[model samples]
Target: MWHMARPRKPLLSRARIVACALALVDDEGLQAVTTRRLAAELGVRGPSLYNHFRTKDDILDAVADAVCADVDLSMFEPYTEGAEAAEGAERAGSTDGPGAADWQDALARWARSYRAALAAHPHIVPYLARGPGRRPSQLRMADAVFGALTAAGWSRAQATHIGATMRYFVAGSALGSFARGFVDDAELYARDYPHLDEAHLLAEYQQRVDDGAFETGLRALLAGLAQPRDD
Candidate 1:
């Protein structure tokens, strides 16, 4: 009697490798991600990973790009396209226009989206500040921000600075752990630190406090960017 051969395991692909690496990082922080660990997670040999990635850093870069790909870049599209349309309309004597306010709105939306993406994968926050480099998703994000700003009448220099500024704010916000640092007990701060009387409140309203702070800072940054500039 002939028996059917067991179905073969799905062949490993770069996407599968990157996905497994990301899950590892998500579960156990970036340091937990190793070729051995990934291979084990994938039920493959360590050398099998090298066939897809040159080194651990290559896998990490792919992970970072994957995280960036999750960011909502659609926010920039309306403003970028609207600005272009407005410019064309202006040449045709139309009064309606997209302006600095539009750019500010788009940037604020982008900042929130960026922060949310990073917050969801806090494990990757440490690597994001290194800039997009050769990562296509991150590069696309940067290009969208730059394109929107420049289209809204910002000079190339100003657009570059704004992109950097937004990136700094979003990354810095994600890096902070203000709410998590507070203890739930009021007495924890009662003795030597009366100024910390509100410590319990922090634990009670941790998420609100963090979100409020982010929004406050984001609004302030966008407002400042909306100001008229000589350059």
Candidate 2:
């Protein structure tokens, strides 16, 4: 007698599951994305998820990694190929001492890319404060920061400190943006306070704006980092 073949495993993999989890957080918020909930959505039992991921934290880490992957690392490079090639051409044509270069612009670009990505995945911003593993992607990001600082003539130690300070500020600001109500509940507050009503905190008609708070803090942090350390 021939036995019926078992159903092939679903095409779903761990990464897909993590992506689904990210969407759950993005749409319904993080509290809605428990392992049991995800398993049901995936058409698998709760324990089945453990076959792909050992624990809830493991799934969370994968989600953070997935979000961070959205940032473009090449743009964080100290000099893009085009910039480097142009510099080479400039050296060939002129006898100038050296072109004025500022690594702050590159670092600012890196911070902007980081803030934009993390703000989009606000739930995952916390994990970045804990730092990434010693993987190739993580190393590349670290290298990019270091490369930018070194190009501006900072020592290794100074560059490391500068990179850490920038990362912390970006992650912290993203968390703040996420806490601001998706639809600000100004109406509730306005009922009690006249000033709140006058300010129209819930005004959606205004053009969407970032308030530039993140960039402002970034500049402040850089100013501090550029100062001479007492120790």
Candidate 3:
């Protein structure tokens, strides 16, 4: 009997499909990620992709999850439980202060990191904003934020509200660039608005202007939500 030996590895996989799909999404918008286009990008046949994902949406789900995986969730570790929580809190405090880190500080770190991850793939934000769905990483992120808040003295309802609020803030921030929308035309603003004198320079310092705005807004939001709990 002549038996042919099998190849050491398969020609395609779910991970490869997702990586290619994500790259396509990052390069083009979600609409650009068709099965044919994905197969073309991966140097494989369209049928090969079917071996991994049953549909284009499934591929997108994987890509969205991959983006969620990039978000840093370590900030919530401090609010866990027991001795581990104490150590994590100490580490967080070491970064923000000499005392145990406050819940505000933990959330601030998480929000900044989340915004950064989304900013890197602004094209994918719309799809991600559709909600976590069955994405493990996205769900895990939601869990961490809610759990940390409840542990830090907030009621369950308050924790849910805070999580939703922070998510909205971060997602909105990454949806589009505020500074980049401004034009470097001092004359335009001078004749009309009469106030935006330095508006012309905003385009040149887009990063600084936008980052400062995010920090300011983030602080204000957290402070506003800091009132005594009703629940």
Candidate 4:
């Protein structure tokens, strides 16, 4: 008996293209993610990529959206619905009802999650600063943040400012590269720069330093935003 050939799998798709492109960027850098390279990675012709994405920027936008989709916005659910608020409160073991204070807590949790997402994909952090534009996932995150702030009784202007401030903080922290920037050799700092002598110690505790600084700044920002403002 003659056996028929197995059906050929689909060679290309938007999701496949995007996944390969993202992996290329993760392994190499954003600069290395050319259409030709991506096509090769997908085992297709360079022009085949155009079937899914119009240009390299389109692919990058998808990658950025993928990163944004990884962020945990569950904390903001309580702000939008009463049932979620009750559920979240019960899960957190909080006897006090969800209120403005809960909004602050949710925002803090959201901020941390957002930071972690960016930290995991440091190569994409630069592209993120360009704003959400037409990216659906990024837009959703912005909506959740703004909705939570407004629902918590903050004025539209205040909420907008707070959102901008938080984005700046998260983006800045991801771009700083503190761990890789610190010098581990004490001898690198001469007497002329005595203030840099202890810098070597920072290399051993880079994570703690970076995390502590972020938390401190985030707390201060939240505290300030929580206060009454003339505006």
Candidate 5:
């Protein structure tokens, strides 16, 4: 009797499992990611998932980490000096302390990249807002931000505030769209809402409008947090 050859690779895997779960969340919503639905999506029995993830939350945690892994932390790299930082260098008139403009440029780049990652998977934004929660990629991002800030002259507590403030702003921006909140009904807004005469056009201009808002906010935020401590 010939026995079935085990395929070169197992059909079920942690990566496959997480990918499928992420797809489920992306296609439907976070609530749609139950183990049964996930198993159905993966073409496996429900119990099969337990071999990799112990609970649904475990699967979600993995999904969250997977998203986190997409973020770019390279702007925080120390060797950035004399290259792009040099270009941004003259932009800073401050020789008062650590190069604040370099930090500002790094932050703007990081913010844009971070928002792009979260924007690609808007449905998962709620899960990500909960913070790092022991996720490796999330933890690494946090480390890079804090380390870079302190190295650039922020005290530990100030670095922590900057990190938290960035998270709040970025997460809130990614959570939903201001433009989409308005219905595209010109007639409806024309009468009662005087200022919203152009509001009806918002949804159609959603991406452009939202991108402008994020950029404006990011600029203001980086400026507000710009630091060259006196002490």
Candidate 6:
């Protein structure tokens, strides 16, 4: 009897798998990300993927962490400097501080960067409903936000609350527009909803996009948060 040659191990790695999954999500949307699909893309069998990730949910969680890692810190870097000080130290400097700034402006920039990242990976937003603690990069991202806020004359307790609020707000903001297209971005019946028709709601779909909504909400949040708190 002749001996058969064994199959070679694939060129795949966990990082490659995660990256490919993200790209698939970006191009065709998240629903396209399946182990079978991913394996096919990697030129391996679906079972080979399990050798790296246990289940689809595990892969999704990893993808969420990967998405958080992509946030742009360039805008938020200034405020994060000296952001890790103790009470009355005048700064919060930690070489490891989140996103690199120590003021609300820094936080705002950080928020925008985060929004951009999520917008790029819309499929991963739903997984964030559970919040950031589950993933290492997300938890680090959260820590940076809290650090920046606390450095800006906000208390640690207050910073935590504000950070939570911002995370929820940004996640919702990115997803809201995505949800809109889920129904229809086209015209509705003019006979129905006279007020909406009169307002030209259907025609100016692009204009209807409130690009400033995030800034407006951020300003409002900071203004309210900066005020003296009973606690």
Candidate 4 per-residue lDDT, tens place, 35-83, comes to 9998887788999899889999999999999999999999988777854
Q: Judged by lDDT against the true structure, how good is candidate 4?
A: 0.84
Total backbone collisions, model 2? 0
* Candidate 6 Cα deviation (angstroms), residue 135: 2.1
TM-score of each: 0.88, 0.69, 0.85, 0.86, 0.86, 0.74
Model 1: number of clashes? 0
lDDT of 5 by residue, 1-231 (tens): 999998874599999998988888888989999999888877889999999989999899999899889888887785334334544654775333333447778878888888888888888889988878888989999988887777677788888988899988888898789999999888888999988999999999999999999999998888787455743
Stretches of candidate 4 exceeding 4 Å from the true structure: 1-10, 82-101, 228-230
Which regions of candidate 6 fall more than 4 Å away from where they truly are?
Answer: 1-10, 27-32, 74-102, 178-189, 198-208, 228-230
Runs with alpha carbons beyond 4 Å of true place in candidate 5: 1-10, 79-101
What are the RMSD figures for all models against the true structure?
A: 2.9, 5.9, 5.9, 5.3, 5.6, 5.9
Highest TM-score scorer = 1
Of 2 and 6, which scores higher on lDDT? 6
List ranges where model 3 is wrong by over 4 Å.
1-10, 83-101
Of candidate 4, the 10-residue stretch with the lowest lDDT total is 95-104
Estimate, for each residue in 60-160, the C-alpha lDDT of model 2 and write its tens digit. Answer: 77887777777777654435443465567777995332234456776777788877888888876666567787434556777777766655556678888
Task: For model 2, give the 10-residue run with minimal summed lDDT.
Answer: 202-211
For candidate 5, the TM-score is: 0.86
Model 1 CA deviation exceeding 4 Å by range:
1-8, 82-101
- How much lDDT does each candidate structure score? 0.85, 0.70, 0.85, 0.84, 0.83, 0.71
lDDT of 1 by residue, 15-79 (tens): 99988888887788999998898888888899998888999999999999999998888978776
